[model samples]
Each structure stands twice: as structure tokens, then as C-alpha cells.
Target: MNLKSAWSRRSFLSSLGVASGSLLTSATAKAEGMFGKKPKAETKRLVDGNPIVPITSGLGSTGDIYAELGVKPLINIVGTVTVIGGSVMKPEVMELIRRGNEHFVLIDELEVAAGKFIARLCKSPAGYTGLVTGGAAAAMVVGYAAMMTEDLEERIKLCPDVATFPRNEVIIQKAHRYAFDHQIRQTGAKLVEVVTREEMIAAINPKTVAIHFTNIQSDRGQVSGPETVAIAKAHGIYTFNDASADVPPVSRLWEYPAVGFDMVTFSGGKDIQGPQASGILIGKEELIHWALLNMSPQEDRIGRCCKVGKETIFGLLKALEIFVNQDYDETLRMYDARAKLISDAIAKFGVTARPREFNPNALGNVTPRYSWQIDPTKLKITGQDVMQGLADTKPVGIGSFGAGAGGMRGRDPEAEARMKAHPELAQQRRRGNGPGRDPNTFGFAVWQLKDGEDQIIADRLVEIFSAAPKA
Candidate 1:
């Protein structure tokens, strides 16, 4: 009866020959390109470009809980990972950013002033420099430039052009290859990916600008602090130890560089609670100096693009002072408590949930992950469903994907039962298609959860579970 149905008859078919056919095709096929065009591929950043998810006011500016037949969603128990723009700035950091915004000084002078302090904190020898960049990855690129060739002459020149100086190849292990390796290329340095101790050692040539050690322990090529620094030293190559999000178990604050790695990087926003756009690039003074020289406010410098607002730099320093001295053990205990909350929630669902303590020597950080074993006969969801469901939520959400080895959706016998038993109740489920109770997906993350939000979660879950049809 409508246009589509009307098109099936002979008259409609006859009309589809010439001019009419073109119009029909245009309407039928979306004017060739006029239909529902899918959105562009999404990046790590969120829709608004600013990456904070409002905890109190959600996507719709509604309260955390929807009427949900009378239920609120659960508080996040997950740590502040990317899906959530790292972590919130500590109050002290926020205040500093606010104050710094009020005035302007020579960015170069600011760099000079901050560098002195950063060098002292890292215990690097003089000429130790300070540079502010968007984050650790930015630091890697800028730092690479400094170690390669400093000053105007070589700063702009890249490898193959400078035969006399180090050609600047960054060595990374096969197993230790990281997502940020691409950052090194930004500086015109080539990345030589190697696997095994032999390949790593042999891979280093005179052209090598620096040897990069990704923070991890399990990979055979994963080096200890002493070994990594030692190898780079023998080759006269600068050593870069990248400990991206590996904070917590505070000893690491002084560990990597202390072991002699020439340079180190840390995220300011993670455990440090500094500004989200901030991070710490600590190590040899001279290299840092050169690195600092390459960033914004320095015209035509190879490191010119990455800019760290003066406020973010200052806030990072303050956050570091607090982070390095705070009661680290207390922080770990809080994480433990959060993990326990997730486990406790899962227990009611009849799933055996346990906290997996991460090894510091391995990944170089100490955070806990919640691993769950659900019996599938009772649950109908799949991990993919859960991830998609969470993403589809009004406010949208994110969490770890494919955590454990076994797939709960496919093999678990009581997965459905486990979903039903969850304390927060999966029955009425925040009232959308619940993540298909996927086995690979654990219930949810404890990362995003802050102080005092468990009850809303409990009530919401109960509502979801309560609404389900009786088996």
C-alpha cells in the first residue's frame, strides 16, 4: 500500500524504465548516496571531544538511575581507564589549573623552571630538562628527538640524512610491542621490532638512538631495570622505559629510572590524580632539556606540535609530589575493597568471582582485575552483548573486553543462572537490551566506581532480574 509495496505491480514496473526509473532508483537506493550514511569510525575520544562521562548526570542529563520501573543503574566499580578519560584531577590539581588559567608567562621560562624540579625528583644529572606534553606518548616522540639530535641543525633532520650522528632507531621487543610504538615514528625515528634476547641484543646498531623497554615482565624479551639500562649503556644508546598506566605499588615511582634507565614516563591522571592531559617525563637532564626545547612555543622545533598547557605541567608536578609520598599501601587497600565489592556482587549471582592481582615485575603495575566464572545454562548473554549493551546505554559505557581465556557464552553450563543471581539483579536491567550476559564479559568493572555508590547498583540490578520471565 505504501511506496515500496506499490512498486511491485506492473504499472510501477513500467514506470521504472527511464526518467521514472531514475527517480525510483534514487528514492529506492537513497539518491545513490542520500540514504542513512553510517557515522565515521570512532576514535578513543568521545562524541563531545571532551572525554569525561558525567557520573551524576548521564547522557540524557537524567539522574544515574532511570525510572526503570523504579531502579537506578549501578555505580562503576572499574578503575578509571580510557573509556573514562583516565581519572579525575585531584581537587588540588583542579585548583592549580584554575589559577594558572588566570595568567600567562613565557612558556619557555615555565619549561626552564619546571625542568629543574623534575630533574631533581628523578635524580638525573644536570642539563636534565623538563618539557610538558599532552601525555606519555607525546613525551616519547619529543624525547626521541632530543636523544637523536638537539638544536636547530639536527632537530629538523631525520635518519638517512645524518650519517655522522646516531640515526636514531628505537628498539622494541616483539612480545613487548605496545600500542604507542607509533608515537616514536612521529619524531622520524625508525622502530626496529625484535623478539627474544638475542634479537634484541643483535638489533642494536650504531644507528640506534635509543632502546625502548615497554613495562612488562612476562615476555621473554621483557628486561629487568638493570639489564635494560646496562644494554643501552654498553651501546651508548639512551634507554627509554615506558611505564604507561603502571602506577600503584608506589615503589615503581623510583624504581625504573633509579635502576639506571636514562628516561621514564608516567601518566599523571591515573593513580597520581593529576590533570587528565598531564604526565611525567623524568630522566636524564640533557635529554629532557632537548625534549623540552622541541615542544610548543618553540617555533619550528621538531617537537613543536605536542603542547602541554602550563597549568597541566604544574598540576602534574604537584600530583607527583603527593603521589610519591602518599601512603601507597592505603591506595592498594582501596582498590582491594573495590574489587571485593565486584566479587561480592557476583557471588549472589552464583558466579565465582575472584580478584586477579596483577604482578608488578610483569606488567610493572599493581592493580586488580575481576575475573568471573559463570555457569551458562542460566544466563543468555554473551560478552559481546554485554559490551554492546553497555555502549548502547543512554550515557554509554566501557569496560575490559575478552578478559579470560575461556568463553562463558559458549561453554559455561550455568551462565544464565549466574546472571539471574547477580545481587544488583539482571531482571529489569536498566531497561534496555542487557549486554547479552556474555560469558567473556564479567558483570561490570570496578574502575569507575568512586565513594558510596553501591546501593543504587543493588536496587537497579534487582529490578532487572525481577522483571525477567519466570523459568
Candidate 2:
């Protein structure tokens, strides 16, 4: 079936399930009354129609658990971001996760089976397979550990202390170094920084385990992917590509490994809409085997903390299956429709909302975005003001307006202190108030918004503009 049909069916089934649960409750109450016993008091439920599993009581529910705790849930306009919670799981994926919880199985056998399934689905190069990880970062720790330790139990136990190991160095481009490198560093391997192809070649020595390529920054570095692969191949060194956020062309899932990166990692939670804590690592069979040995269901290893549950593995597999087969053109159209709805609603307020064309080669979280240009002459409020206004909306806050303006709502004194201590961090705030950071403009992608959220956003925008004074 087409993606549109599949999505419609999934939504219908989800609604049917909720309706069935409600009907069951009503019938039970009626039966109790018919038997002449007083019907039990109706218990309040968490908003969003899903009762918290294991069902706790005494929680008043005008909203979801977030609201119960005085935190506002948001209409996510941001692409998959871990801070606000990654993309929602497809109904089928959630069903698989729930099903997986019903029976216990040997995690080792499950991982191997899942790996074979992933390898076949993604079309990884021969001698390569897949492994579910805690997250993309966990994949790095285990992938690097696999290269450094191989299959030796003695070496595995002594990981992160590879001071005496023959291969403890990872080569990376100077420009490619980012926050996620901490994962590589966690394995106790020293990162050898190289700026040029010649420098990379010269830096490789007896200790070099692999060349770490940051996929999104492939163009920024002097050495290209093919060149890096060639260099690694020539030297008999391993290569790993951190392509976590790179998908949507879905073909990239196998393409990178096909290009000779011995290991490649992707965030299952991001575009795949799998469990938030899950990731996929596909690479050489030998390396993946070593990675698995170092991770969960094993003891006293460097990756012991990075455990992947059976449910998460199943959910990620289902998500991957859906993601690969789903239609993208239809998805884009749905996003466009959502943007147009919000745009039309606020047009009278002099805000022009135009959709940005999707770039096929966008580095990560690829999605079409909508840019809202506020006509200063028609509306006194700036785009940042509108963002904040949306964030302050009642019932649910519409968010993902780039950090301080709205994305992070609560006060964070610790973060403020860190910013104060590290003045350069001020420059790191996303899309700061400078060029292209027009005060009269703000934008976000609509693909992440749930059903009917676009209308809520439209109604909220109307409320915000209605309250703003005319210019």
C-alpha cells in the first residue's frame, strides 16, 4: 500500500483501539449497575487519551503528565530533537514494542537476528551486518572499542585503558571534531587531528585504529569520503562514519557502508521515528561482532552501560521497515498543507509565510521549512515576539523557535552560569540576532507536528496577532 493509505490505516486503528478501551470501561460500569452494586467512580485519565501504563491514580488530568507536573507540552515545529523528545513512533512500531515485551528471549540471539534483518533491509556490503545501540553516540563507543579490542576478552575488559593496546588512536579531521567526539574519547582512545590529506596519512601509525569521518561535515574537510576510504584501505586501517542524522534519501542507509566505511551509525529515533533511546550500527561483520561482545548481556565491558532492550530493537526494526517503504512525496505534500493552513490563517496580520524548498543534500534532519516574514509596517511585533507568544499559549505551547526565543522555556540558572563562564558559548546560540536572524522573521518545519496540531498553531497565531498592537 502507499504511504498515505498506510498512515490513514494506522491512525484509524489507533483511534479504534482508544475507542474500544473507552467502550469496555463504559460496559463494565453498566454491568455493575445492572447487578445492583454501586458503579465504581470514574478515574481521571492522562490527556492525549493514552493511560499511563501500569495505571497510577490521583493524578488530575486536564492535560498529559507534563501538564500534571506543571510543564507545558509543545506542538513540535522543530525537526527531531532529543531535547523536546524525538519524533513520535509510528503506531505499528509501538505495537511491535508492546508485543516484544510479552515474551523474554536471549538478547544475544535477538541482536544477531535483528542484525541480519537490518543488513538485508539496508543492503549493507557483504561481510557487514547491523546492531541496535543505545543511541548513535553509544554506537561510536562500541564501534571504536570493537576496532581497538577486536574479540579478545582480556582486551575488552581493559577497554578505555587502552594505554597499552596496539591501536588506541582514531584519526579525525580538525574541522570534523564536535560534541559527539566525546563518545570516541570515552573509549580511552586518543583522537589524532589532521587538517589535510597528507597530514592524515602522516598521522597514521601503529596506534591508529580507524579514520573517523563526520558525515555531515564531509564537504568541510580537505579529505573526501572516497579519499579517506582509499587511505584507510591502503593502510589496512578501519573507517567509521557518524551519519546519525543523515537519512530521508533512505538510500544513504546502505550507500555509506557501500562506500567502504567499515562502520556507519544512524539515530533510529530521529528520522526513523524509532525509540528515542535507540540507534543502528551497520558495518563489517567482524567489527559488529566485536561491538556486540563489548555491549550489553556481557559483563565488565566498556559498552556495558550502553544496553539495547529487546523491545527497542524490535521497535527500531519495524520503524526502519516502515521508513524505507513509505512514500516521501506524499509526506512533503502533507507538510506543505500544514504550512499553508497556518500561513493563510495569519495572512491578515501581515505575516507572509512561504515554504522553503527541500534541499536533497541537506546535512541532517532533512525537511521542508516555512519562513514567516512579518511586515513591520502592518504589525508592531517582531518574529521573536511571535515565537515567544506562541510558546506562552495556554493548553499547549507551540515551540521549536530556536532556543532562548522559545525552544527552551524554563529558567536554567546552571546553563546561564556556564554561559557566563564560557563567553564563546554566547556565539553558539542558534541563529542569533544578526544577519539572516531577522527580528521580523521566524520559521520551522511542520513535518514533526501531530495531527490537528497545525490547526492549533494557526488558531494560536491568530490569537497572538490579534493581541499585538498595529504598527
The backbone clash count of each candidate, in order, is: 54, 0
TM-score of 1: 0.67
User: Any runs in candidate 2 off by more than 4 Å, and if so which?
Assistant: 1-63, 400-431
Worst 10 residues of 2 by lDDT: 1-10
The C-alpha lDDT values of all candidates are 0.62, 0.87
Q: Candidate 1 — what's its lDDT?
A: 0.62
The candidate that achieves the highest TM-score relative to the unseen native structure: 2
Give the TM-score (vs. native) of candidate 2.
Answer: 0.84
Model 1 has how many clashing residue pairs? Answer: 54
User: What is candidate 2's CA lDDT for residue 132?
Assistant: 95
Instruction: Highest lDDT: give the candidate number.
Output: 2
lDDT of 2 by residue, 343-426 (tens): 999998888975576897788778887888999998899877877777777777778554555446777769878888987667
List model 1 lDDT by residue over 229-248, tens digit each.
Answer: 78888878888888868776
